[model samples]
Target: MDDLPDDALGDVLRRLPPRWLAASRCVCKAWRRTIDERRLLRPDLLPLSFAGIFIQFDSHAFPEFFARPSPSSANTKLDFLP
Candidate 1:
């Protein structure tokens, strides 16, 4: 497979689904470079976003909240308590 040109290798890899594409990345450095250089796999397709977290303690009445701070979250409030 190393003998294959990048264009040809990329063509073959492009048809694979996200799962296989990720596996191909681990095959070798050349294949990984080709995949990254041609953008065969999109970073946005992977789940890398951090939204928020909730933690509850045995002694607490409510769960503690920790969220990723963003402009849209500026007005966000924890009004779930009653």
Candidate 2:
């Protein structure tokens, strides 16, 4: 599989069931990169973790959001006006 070109590998990965495709990602960095780069996995199908919540109070001009120090939230920014 390592010898296979990225396009070919991605084609093969796309054929696998979601479960198997996920396991294939753990095979190696190349495989993982191929999967991610091609977006072979459906994000909605994967398990989701609770990142945080946004609270808006009537008196407050802006909403307040709380999130764990996670990669997902590292670039999160709230820029809406109340």
Choose the strongest candidate by lDDT.
2
Candidate 1 per-residue lDDT, tens place, 4-56, comes to 88899989999999988988898889998999999999897765766798888
The RMSD of every model to the true structure, in order and in angstroms, is 8.8, 8.2
Per model, state how many residue pairs clash. Answer: 0, 0
Candidate 1 local distance difference test against the native: 0.86
Q: Give the distance in Å from residue 12's predicted Cα in candidate 1 to where it truly belongs.
A: 0.4
**Model 2 spans with C-alpha error above 4 angstroms:** 51-82
Candidate 2 per-residue lDDT, tens place, 1-82, comes to 6678999988988999999998999999999999999999999977788879988887756889999876664645666646
Q: Go through the candidates in order and give each one's C-alpha lDDT.
A: 0.86, 0.88
Roughly what TM-score does model 1 have, to 2 decimal places?
0.58
Error of 2 at 64 (Å): 22
Tell me the deviation in Å of residue 79 in model 2: 12
